[model samples]
Target chain A: MSNKYRDKKTGITRREILKVLGVSALSYGFLGASSKVYSKSTAHIVIVGGGIGGATAAKYLRLLNADVKITIVEPKSQYIFCPGSNEVIPGWITLEDLMVTYTTLKTHYRINVIQDKAQSINFDKKQLKLEGGDTLTYHKLIVSPGPTHHYEGIEGFNKELAEGAFPSAYSAGKQTMNLRNQILSMKKGGTIIISSPEDPYRCPPAPYERASYIATMLKDNNPTAKLLILDSKDDFIFSNNYLVYWEKHFGYGKADSMIEWVSKKKGGNVVKLDASIRAVITSNGDIHKGDVINIIPPEKAASFALQNNLAEGDWCPVDFFDFSSLLHDDVYVVGDSIEGDPMPKTGYIASNQARVVVQAINDELHGREVGSPFIINDCVAMAGQDYGMALAETFRYAGKGKKLGERYHILGAEKNKGKQIVRQQVAENWQRTFRKDVFE
Target chain B: MNKYLLRLFFILSSIGFSNSALADDDLTGGLSLKENFELAKKFPMPSPWLLSAQCSACHGTLGTAFNEIIPPLAGMDKQEFIKKMQEYKTADASNFIVMGIIAQPITDEEIEAMAGFFAKLKPEPLNQEKIPRDVVVPEWAVMNKESE
Candidate 1:
């Protein structure tokens, strides 16, 4: 009804505009702009997936422009975070602690929370089809379907195998628990085979973190239990710290070390699985038997993204300008769905990508030129509860049609115990705070 | 933009901004810190950092403050914010190599706007009803002393 919203050429008022949008304000997101806060924007933004990236996008979009219509289409009403999910495996944290709901997103941010799976996107019509054949239209679409583990990539593995006996547990839900329970009940002096996949997986250091935590969990309880980390990559993200911590605590590098890492160079790549016997066949044709096998298979963008033509190959190509799909206009590919190399696929990185995309969209609505992006990743990793580590990197846009240029730095080993404790404590705190930041 | 000139300009500009746009700040005035943050989302930001997304990555949003390694700046003293920023700009801040890299492109004008935006949010102290988070407020990070 405000005169400022008048369509001069069509003589249509802003009230008429809403009437044409026709959807219920609550059903389609309708947070009115506070005159003292922000200018009203009529742009409609839709996001798929309600994980860290999508949720953050919805929150930030509202913060930047109160009038922008935002909707999130997620299959599950509750989201389980994969970050602190590692602790769940060791019983250090529960799945409940890692769980969050979309209620706050709907109530506090006034974002439309559609409890349904986004079936397919009608790019031509700018419409997203829900499960029941219902549709929602948008001016911009954000795709943040997290990574999908390629269990099929392994000769003898599949999703069923991942969920049942040979648990991938990478996505961090029921499988994480299955894996945890399996380790807890294993016999004393048992060997647990944790086969890690190639590079470019989510949280590059996580598999190692899991190995460390698993080692700690068994240090006192099942003292002779050993953890075999068979990795596809020759080297991993935090080998320096992991080896040091492993040696100090688990007597790593000794004859009866608690944890033994088999790098790719040493025929450590697990090419096949024998779930019946709880054994893994590496590329070098070595069959290693174990009491429990955690096959964290290689990963690719979620199937939904690939099926809907949002991806080029293993991942979706994005414009550094705003994370918009390079192949599709008005469609943004964020989180693990993106092929952003040098910038690892991490929750921290995904959240940052969401921020950049929303800012770019907001700028476009204001009829301003979208500036080159400066993406930063503060990757904080911890091996044990006592030693924490951090890697800080900056990715800046090089130019049109080029991926982002990069700058990297990481915290070095400290000599003192207090410094190590501080980092470790901070890592724990960061996990809790980051969880609340997105969901709470 | 010289830092001093930028500060002077912001001071001159806020005379009008405070008198007009902020005249009806009733919602934020009597609300709880949590309620204030929910309301602050609607508050318009200044230039360069028009969106909280730019700073919120490392700084954490109002909902989640960074671990004690990086101090929360929202509702922090303006002069204190400015001093820390200046130190980073001049490469005088030790143990903040990341901040130095991030602050390189931030202009004096942008710095003023960042301070103004946080101060206006009126963030309450992080004492009672603290959100579950991993945060450490070490002395080096808390070098945000106000200008007397």
Candidate 2:
């Protein structure tokens, strides 16, 4: 094979020397002494998680380099995207519509798809141990084991409860369907309580979007029903847009409004979920009961990163230059797992971070300096099918040991009906295009 | 002594990087000595391909969009792409919404590099047989001779 994959050693090998000499002589004969030679590499890149970040890493890595072996270790064969999953709650979209398979990554890109869970990482040996007891060695590793929902963060709420009555449809899966079915079957004029968690969570605008969409669903089916959003944080992303939409449609801020939002200052931080009584206890000891409860739990770096000592507190710290893990060399952490602030946790940012990491690894394999990273997050959120909003954020690499500098601009909620409809359509188009970009 | 010399060689080699390398200085105007030194210590600017890849999230892969709410960028006229991007970057808030803000942080040279990249790409055809969706072009995104 190619000399680009020559194993690292203290001195150059004889074959490499001979290859260089042959290249130089051939260049001298063909053109001149100025021609430089580059070749394909045999380096193996192993990625954890098969969500947006992991899938994008596999796809984009193939685009940048053809010879390097890329493998993705994901337990599920198909992924249900969380971007448009909020639409599943109101029957605007189905879970099947958001599902994507790894078949394209395998057949088109020739990537190795290992349908197995990543057990742990052996940093010393640079090996990732899979749940099936297979060990895969890699020249570089990318870990994007998306965020873990700590359902226990709210006392009395556990995984079983989430699967049953109080469905936290944060991750778009069975819980998403459960939440939707709960809303559909609730008694007329029944109350639905959606407990939104604090900051630094995946898709910051999702919980609010879920609230808005569910409000629309209620307006159509259960007109007299109430939807209360108890938020842990004081305010949320796209608050202006969501608030404006809520007021116009759901009679928000009125005496007999269909929808009401309780911020943390107003005793909305849900500390406990009393499943026995179908009530949630706020931090201020206020008990609010509901017929349907959807608790979006607080989050932390996935268990894979936490157990392997890749996390510092709740997230993994990464060098902004390439998203290489600060704790381990030759290892990278992207997506919601990294301590990426000044950069919110969103799928768009995660995919962009994956692109940066692969470029860095490809550069290093080619014996070149890894490039500085610039990330852009074009966050698109919809308050309704006809109303959408967007935020543009750009992060620039500052230096070694410094967070990437950030600039963000968000448009105020659109007042023009035509613009709002167009933005909504654009958001819809983006979801379909983004899904194909990563998986297909 | 040899290690230091090798380090110096890499730093110096980075300065006059070839077109294939796509160094920041090679694409952009140029970097100051201080900026170059900072780069020498860490990493140089990312490739233009990586910068443009960010658009695919909304604009479609390589700007070959299946729908037309947002205009595709693949096979766009080089100068035309540059002009629109420059307009978006320099235009007031009322001119556009998200693209203007997104274009603000990106350097003009980066935009030029991106424009050059999209100009060369051949956009993939929409497989209408598989993806049966209607295309609706927005008013603001409509191309005109004056804008070009």
Candidate 3:
């Protein structure tokens, strides 16, 4: 009814309008009888964050419905993928190798990419207020801002210390290069401490992979140097594989072993950091000093989700059937921000969550019932360049208000060198193809 | 003015002709084509499309993978896909890196549905231009690129 939407030059007359209405009505009847047809509604779906979840939602939604207006609000113009970033430490892959841009999303998918930070959300108005003072009204909103690293989780360990001396290279940006430089330039016989956080964090196997990669770097660069992993959790995802690799390559169990892991049960849970002395204090009041410290801080839902009341305590809760936020009706949350237990916070899971949400939205637009969500996470991890392991976790929806039922299958470390090498090659190829699938 | 009105009339009338004609014969359960379509629209479960989409992470969207090691599933023969999946599901654990495990949870009905879904899609070859300039495409992958 607005003048902006009207054809000004043609100036539609009443007779013409009536004719169009009558014809369209008849066309709708014929099309409805013949096929399942969904008309183009002026629905604008606004997504926050341009990580795997948001990007996948935008692209997949466009695939399901060609006419819905999709807009993504993210601060960064380029996203450095975190999946293969562990290889960056050992110089096998560079940061640029994991970098992806929004060019394909904009040009090919015709998605509106607003390189602006989302400030807050007005739930009642269904409008997203941006930091640049622009408010975008949306029919539905998806928030996938990833996790916010809670640096204060460890006393005396803050963001400033993380960026300055001790780098928690969790998100694969400047800190990743920083950690790599520290490892390359450390003293001979020096110790590099990696304080791993507890469960319910992003990439459950990342800290161990980081240790393995750094061990490889030290074995070549500083042969006498030591790598210590202080885990807040008693066990990790790929401990069996990592142990075998470390024992074979670095003499993990020997008295003069190059790499050592102290689990929380063994008083390895770091409670505080004495940054001035480059030491971490464990739960039992033991102080361990290192030449370089990489403390991966605990994480919570992103700040935007917290500010807008999309989260409950630490993470946002959602109906697993469609990943719609439990707090807000028209808003949905996905990725590391959600309370998706049994589903490790991985990019593959995030992409699938996006697919479920988009499919639900598309079905609702067509007046169809939202279908069940079946998510499969095929996680491929590497202990070293030659040895790789993979796990397949399937998450099935139980019902409303219940957690997704999960079944996990992970093979132990490969004993055969040929099979291990092939698996490594498969893992490497999967990273490249995954990048293309999400971005291109 | 007369020409504009005539053009509008043609455009309006053509809207009904855009789609192909549906079969007039009654389908299974003795339902007409429209009734069957309605029944399908109301079907509570749609696990096939949802299940097949999760494979996009490693297999590429709709299984059109460009990686040399991971075989693309789009345009694969339905019977072949079903057989391969069943083999992986029941084969020795060491035979496959992850496919054996990944295929275990899916039911046979879901497998057939997924097979049919992927079989209908035409596989597309990788567009070399879409490959980022800095990425090092493996020699095997580059050599194995199929013509469109």
Candidate 4:
């Protein structure tokens, strides 16, 4: 240890650098910013769904506790991220880049990655029944089974339409390819209609971002193509940014504009689809035809969560502070499944909620009181590769029966060109890296 | 214009620069953390390690609580973190071959995120009792606790 400081070139090791730097660097300046805890206890923690939320929960649980036995029950061997997956529309990334497996969680963290569907939970006995006819007992449980689309809710649209001709592409695997192909093969002056769902959807900015990217692609090859967005929501997350991007590239609100958005207030809620005629009927009886129709339907907690009675209405109600399911004991739901209203079901929010749940469990094991939490969502969205905008909302839990003290700090559109491009790159890099952060 | 004079001038300037920087005994890389915090706030990722790609295998999210032998990047002064990483990009940054080799292929943007992430992280005193697993408390952490 004594020779650790001996450097050959300048006789300056990292030890020398640390000593040269003052102690104020760690003088509780950084540490005092937040009260973080670390303690361990032995217990079996079972997490269902190996997507972003469950994977993150398992990782943080292991990071905070060295001895907890964590077993993640997921059906698939790999999880494909949906964060920047809309880039797949414009051929920015492949589906493989979004895919991640459970090898690291199993080998490095000593987490048991069981490849099977979590059929049901025996709440009274604190047990989980797997589809493979095995039962596992747990002291704590996390249910992060992500969204199950209600494709049939829209008349004349079902799983088949999403799979073959009219693609939803919301789930980021097979349908993604279908949508990309349809966009590529779309005829000159052909219209691609993107019917967006209402609020509380995964990545609220996706439909608009999808439209942005589709328009971007159309400009390169099919410039005469028109992309109409029939949105269920009146306004989207980053409306201004999308408008600006469309105006600059596709001539928004113009006679020859390639992009047009019809909000629900303006009869954008699509009711029926005539797949044979390649057209859709909106709520107020207006029929708009398109060459390719991508209908992103309303969502709820996955059938696994709902069938097991994890949801209150369409979403699983949870204690916001700890993300513990309000419906059942020992069950916590994070990610898109949770009734995290005002919190759009984004991947980052899900990951942050996972942290809260982990912290709560760790504190419980250590017999410490979990304090009021401050949840900050740096919700970011980019319009194409050039323009980006964000909403940084800080949510502080005021108390029970009161809403979180929320404040929005937006990275508005007025920022310079360089910052926007950097943000776009950061958003792009974040998707690829977040996949690794969760699974690997 | 001559080759010999140019070589002499380059060596003299390099030597003079190193001596002056070494003479002051001030820890380099002391950029204003406030300014860095403002910039890092603009970034979307929760932490720099997320953006650092493969580095998170050893480096934790905010670059603290690493293995015992290696030092953590957390709470290090922002500018100092940048300087050490800039040095590590060289094949000969240290006699111990690993740091330089691992850091050699890192980009400028990655280095910025690393520096900014660590600087913005909340610091925690290395309590021997807290970290039951193998973790080395650096001399800086030790000195801070003792002084407090």
lDDT of each: 0.71, 0.79, 0.79, 0.67
Reference-based lDDT, residue A316, model 3: 97
Q: Which of the two candidates, 1 or 4, achieves a greater lDDT against the reference?
A: 1
Best by lDDT: 3
Q: Judge candidate 4 at residue A351 and give its lDDT.
A: 77
Ranking by lDDT: 3, 2, 1, 4
Instruction: DockQ for candidate 2, please give it.
Output: 0.15
Q: Any runs in candidate 2 off by more than 4 Å, and if so which?
A: A1-40, B1-44, B93-97, B128-148
What is the TM-score of each predicted model, taking all chains together?
Answer: 0.79, 0.83, 0.84, 0.71
Poorest stretch of ten by lDDT in candidate 4 chain B = B19-28
- lDDT string for model 2 (A362-415, tens) is 887787877779888999899998898877777778788988766666767767
Question: B34, model 3: CA deviation in Å?
Answer: 38
TM-score quality measure for candidate 1: 0.79
lDDT of 1 by residue, A1-440 (tens): 23433443345653454344435323343555321222235556889999989998898888787777777889886787788788877776667767677766665576777778988988766678889666776778999989888999888999988878888889877888788878888999999999999978899889999999999988967999999999999997757667878998999999989999999999999999987787999988999999999999999999989989988889999887689998887899999978998689999888878888888888878877775465667677777767776655656555578766565545455444555655565566667667667776
Candidate 4 per-residue lDDT over residues A83-200, each given as its tens digit = 8778776777666656667766765666777888999888866678999987776667999888988898789989988988888999887888778877887788899999999877
Give the TM-score comparing model 3 with the true structure, all chains together: 0.84
Error of 4 at B68 (Å): 27
lDDT, candidate 1, residue A382?
79
Better of 2 and 4 by DockQ: 2
What is residue A335's positional error in candidate 1, in angstroms? Answer: 0.3
**lDDT tens readout by residue for model 2, B6-101:** 443454355431212111211121233345335434545568888889898988776766454566798999899888776666544223336765
Task: Determine which window of 10 residues in candidate 4 chain A has minimal summed lDDT.
Answer: A33-42
